[model samples]
Target: TFCVLLAYGMLQQITGLRLQDSLGYSSSDAIKGTGALMTSSMALMACVQAIIFKFSVKNPARLLLIGALISVLGFYFLYVGSSFWIYLAGMAILGLGMGLMFPANLALLSLNSKEHNQARIASINNIGKGLGFAIGPLLGATLYQKTTDLPIIFAIGLAIITLILSLISMFPPRIKSVHKI
Candidate 1:
């Protein structure tokens, strides 16, 4: 998971560099600004996730779907964004989705697995992430080389994947309420 996250972070940096180069901006500009945007987005996304968790503790599927939708929109914003502020907003939105996604992914796994098997399930999830990390950079580079719009492509792909996962996560095992409302 760390590798995957690092790859994601690195991909952002690479794409930012590419964008800067293409737009005739200083190469250092994207590198310098990305960290700040990342920090701000991370904070914003954390807040968004907390709100989702507070209200939807038992509905991991719904949370995932909402996060996925927001993420998709964030990606869109990133795709067409022109200014630094626009990029920042788009990044923040993506961060919001990611914040929701991290917890929601865990929730989905937990809801799907029995308590006894949760550890194994989590391991499997981590393995999936490892695979994603291994593949994401190569894929990002390939797509970027082909499209010259790597950021947009990455954003669209993230959105599509989120939507697909959201649909899959919707069918977690139902819990029997201990006490009726």
Candidate 2:
């Protein structure tokens, strides 16, 4: 879970620079554009969160799976897109996924954890988020230096892995019930 968030944080941190370079924007314009992009992403995330909260209280695990899949698509868009609008759209999609996955996963964690360990779990969660914030940019920048799209590839890989793991966790193998005489 934290790994996914970390990858996302890295992508969010560096996407502006990539957009600026790719689009040939002046620094000021790039900053403004990045701001707009981030704001749009965040706004979409908030909306998704609100909608999920209102309507999807019964099935957080399902929501987490959906969010992970959506995030994979979002990363794919970022990897393949060249235009500003396309990138913006990708960011918006990523935001929606983040909104869904973040809260849903947290809720699942809280529900599953023992009461005595709740504080520890919460602490670990915050640490994961902090690490993501710290590491995402550094990792993205290093990968970007190696290849233009490698960071996006890395993010996509992370999202895919996360999605696969979520699927596995959500749908464990079940034993059939036997009828007794």
Candidate 3:
């Protein structure tokens, strides 16, 4: 959750700036572009999540690594792209990635929790999200100052970590092996 949200924050911090500075958009135009990207991506994510929830996918980590991979592609596209359409497409792809991961994280939480403590467990998700979003932009901005690609690179690193974490979560508790006496 933190990894995903942090990636979002890092991308959000730079996309608008890229539109204005790199693509030579006017301030109004940049905002509009950014708004369009954000709204479309969010809508796509919501729709995808809804569909997943409707089907009640049992494997919580199934989409996690895939989503992270897709997100890496999206960020890479943004890194290589220099046009408005390209940027928009990149964001849309990232949105698809977000769609895959959000539900998985929630499902993981629900699967790991008891009915009584579900709300408490859920709060932890919110906390991870808040911290990720909060820190991402600050870290992103500093990295962006060094090089625009830094945030994307950092995001990719986080995605890799998400993959590892998701892999760990996918397994059930290990059983102790008995030795023959």
> What ranges in model 3 sit over 4 Å off?
177-181
lDDT of 3 by residue, 33-133 (tens): 99998887888888888888788676777777677778778777777788998888888888888899888888888977899999998999999999999
Question: TM-scores of all models?
Answer: 0.78, 0.89, 0.88
Candidate 2, residue 152: the lDDT equals: 87
Measured on C-alpha atoms, candidate 1 has an lDDT of 0.69
* Model 2 worst lDDT window (10 residues): 52-61
Residue-by-residue lDDT tens digits, candidate 2, 33-87: 7887788778998999888777756777788899999899888888888888888
- Provide C-alpha RMSD values for all models, in order: 5.7, 3.0, 2.1
Window of ten residues with lowest summed lDDT in model 3: 56-65
Ranking by TM-score: 2, 3, 1
TM-score pick, better of 1 and 3: 3
lDDT of 1 by residue, 137-161 (tens): 6666676767667646664765677
Which candidate comes out best when scored by TM-score? 2
Error of 3 at 170 (Å): 3.2
lDDT per model vs. reference: 0.69, 0.83, 0.83
How far residue 149's Cα lies from its native spot in candidate 2, in Å, is 0.6
